[model samples]
Target: MTASLSQLSGRVWIYPGDPDPEAVMPCVAVVADDAGSTVVDAGQSPAHARLVQSALAEAGLPAARRLVYTHHHWDHTWGACAWEVEEIVGQESGATLLSAEARRSWSQEYLQEQVVANPRLGPSFKARARAMTGWADFAVRAPSRTFTDRLMLSGGIEVRHVGGKHAPDSTVVAVPGSGVLLLGDCFYPPPFHLREPGPAGEEIDLRQISALVAEGFDWYVDSHSPPWRPPVPE
Candidate 1:
């Protein structure tokens, strides 16, 4: 799937994720600043990352000086190496997961074995893996710095650890100046679609979300969806 850069108002731009079978690239956010661009998430592979870089270059946005992961999910963190940034930030838990995942093989046979072992993760896993034509240069790099609760970057962007049922390490990036919140799959349920009478899934915690919304953000960016304006409470 080809990703094109679209401005989400002000200093934010997004490469919306593709839902097609060819590539399930996760949406990547670029927050432009005079210093440098702060990327919310890296895409699935080096190729995907290059696509993002090309899009940014064409848009005349600042080069990505920092890469921040919303979580350690393969779709979000696998492009770390390609970003070539000195600072990669993630939650401590997510950093640990990425460190461990960095040691694993992305081979087709290995991925197939994983799918066979975990039926709940089969469909989407297979689809994402199949989308990739090659993995010769694929590498997973853990964050250079890990934060426990919150971290404030050079720009007005804030990253918070908002764990959800989807992933314990899930986090969201808030650009207060732009009123845009980049949600990294923190509102999704676990693998329940592939199973009948699936195991009870945990509820998505909404307290943090509500509080963040209360903080004056009007636009929300989900990993799989385009940016949207959620009605702000009066």
Candidate 2:
């Protein structure tokens, strides 16, 4: 899959005036073979999923063999149902969190605040919210296999279920062969707004992510950015 999509230089695909201020979420799709591929972090809508699928097809790869959620955040995981995949994988913590009724309440409140604050989103936001109301009912499945520290996949693809930084169940995928690291929301670019205030009132761990970034890779793919070459510090 990487071989086919290797020509795709990762870039930020901006969706204007989306409900969430964190509207420009990043999604990564990797084609493993003719039979399958893996899509990392399905985006906010089915349309987004279709767009991803089309891109992969255009590159002569399957839509996805499996759908892997970087975390349980709505923006990142909402479009999983749209993809044709054999299995859906997420951090164990994400599965637990998604199953709890508390997640629905929290998500609803969060979306409400985002929509109200950004009236520019208009009817499309409300429609999306209404559609997402069923997310609580959506099957939030854990990885068929769980990992604590790090797990390596068939093709030297290493996924580390590092403990929470941005969201409690965040996982980072490292393709050692290609030197590509998909950090999900753990490493947000500038103007970050996903840092919600927690119970103890601490902001999300940007430093933890910075430390993660320091480990280094030739290509750094955020759930939000197109494949990017990490910058060298002065």
Q: Best-fitting candidate, measured by TM-score?
A: 1
> Considering only N, C-alpha and C atoms within 3 Å, which residue pairs clash in candidate 2?
1-31, 10-226, 10-227, 11-226, 26-223, 26-224, 37-65
- Cα error, residue 62 of model 2, in Å, equals 3.0
lDDT of 1: 0.82
Q: How many residue pairs clash in each candidate?
A: 0, 7
Locate the minimum summed-lDDT window of 10 residues in model 2: 9-18
Clashes of 2: 7
Estimated TM-score for each candidate: 0.89, 0.68
As a whole number from 0 to 100, the lDDT of residue 232 in candidate 1 is 48
Runs in model 1 deviating more than 4 A are: 192-208, 232-234
Question: After best superposition, candidate 2 residue 2: deviation in angstroms?
Answer: 22
| Candidate 2 local lDDT, 1-234, one digit each (tens) | 111234432321212213343444345556354556667777655555666666677766654777777777766766666776787777777777756723344345656776789864444355456545344544433455555667666546677776554676778877665666777776442122433455433454677667776888777666654556757999
Q: Write the per-residue lDDT of candidate 1 for residues 1-234, one digit (tens) a residue.
A: 666899987899998888763466789999998788999888887778899999999999999999999988878887777887869999999888888888888778888888888877777678657756678877789999899999998888899998877778999998878879898888877534433353445554567566666666768888887777878459
Cα lDDT for residue 141, candidate 2: 39
